[model samples]
Target: MNDWRSHFGFHTTPFTRELAVAQRFPLPMFDEVLTALSRAVDQRGSAALVAPAGTGKTALLRALVDQLPEARYRVHYVKVTDLSKRDLCREIAVACGAQPAGSFPMLVRRLQEHFLSTLADDGVRPVLVLDDSHGLRPEVLGIFQILTNFEMDSRLVLSVLFVGQPPLRDLLRQPAHEAVTRRLVHLATLRLLSRPESHRYLAHRCTIAGATTIPFDPGAQEAVYEIACGNLRATDQLAAKALEVAHDAGAAIVDSAHLATSRRLLWP
Candidate 1:
């Protein structure tokens, strides 16, 4: 029988298969975010999720959207890195399936009206997900405050969720932003994965990629854990490179040498 390594190309590494592998990796903190966001969505309150880069914030949001039953909610995902109020409004209008019939201000008001009406008709609140919200300008963010006007006494007609880096928490702390910050009833700050968690993460990804057994040697796992520093992105990168190194060396199983090469390629 041909060796497993011989069947797959030398360049076929876990990194190249990240999308497929990542889907199978059980993000442990995902449940926390899901619970928090689900509560916020159900309660019709605002939510803020803050985390460092590569802590899987975006992935969590996508997963949350996927898990939510479509019959109950309409989720609109937006990335607000560098947008003017008008542009932001336009994006929201588009996502909500409303066409603005007049000037930007008039369009915004119309969009707001349309959103509230749609929620009322559908019997389900609308969820607007703002990714990288820290970069939003004060004026653009003010537009978000305007959206809060759609709320009723019982629940919000529209709910907004802000996901961003650590600075977002600091930004919200400013006195001028207090009104908006006060509306955020749900919040979560994601942290790097623990060592054991990281191990499970890597194993999960490898298994998803068709590896029946742990691909890396015991010592190699330690090296990967150290080099990845508990970051999922770095872990994926290292694992991919290690797989490539093993493939190129014609090794049936990944070992320390492959990990060493992976480290040099990733960090250097």
Candidate 2:
């Protein structure tokens, strides 16, 4: 049998590979978002999920995408940050496999028409997952309101799910954005993982990376949880570094020394 230890170097975790980590350390709070998304997609309604930075919002979205039944709906995930309204529309249009012919307004119209046609042909609702929506300009955010108009009497043809940080909630609260905000039937905010949850998260990542058992000592685990401040992103960063330190030292298990070294290296 191949030695699992040899998997080192090739086994590092990445921030973008959220589906793998989410499977190992499932966050229960995201279940509400998943349930809401599934129901909204079925009913063709709209929903929004918001949380603080480093609270695993991206990871939760990735997990939802991974869990979503491919046969039931067409999913288009887009991250809108620092992009102009025209650029955003073009990107969304391209994701849906349609090219816009003219200006920004024309592109929006084309995207809506394309989405409606797609839903009719595929017999499935079109789901648009917009991430970092808080970064969108007021005009661009208005595009979502326009899309929501493409709906039937009982079901919507296009369903939009907005995911972002707390500023997204603040943006929705603005009176100017009331139209889009009012259509959001479901709202959820992801919370930081509790202490035990953090511990489990670290151990889970280690195991997924091929470690048969947790390499961190009890004290080291506590230190990680404390310094990570309940954020999964921070925990993963610290834990991964600790593992690297242990691997380099040929230590079978990570101890207080490894934890201290990793902490100093990461935070200081």
Q: Residue 131 of candidate 2: its Cα lDDT?
A: 91
lDDT of 1 by residue, 45-89 (tens): 889999888778888888778776788778989887687777778
What residue pairs are clashing in model 2? none
Q: Which segments of candidate 1 are over 4 A away from where they belong?
A: 1-24, 100-102, 151-155
TM match of model 1 to true structure: 0.87
Location of the lowest summed lDDT over 10 successive residues in candidate 2: 1-10
Model 2, runs deviating above 4 Å? 1-22, 151-155
RMSD of each: 3.2, 3.1
TM-score of each: 0.87, 0.88
Q: Write the per-residue lDDT of candidate 2 for residues 75-182, one digit (tens) a residue.
A: 898887777878988889877888845798899889888888877887766889999888877667877888777554344678899888888888888898899888
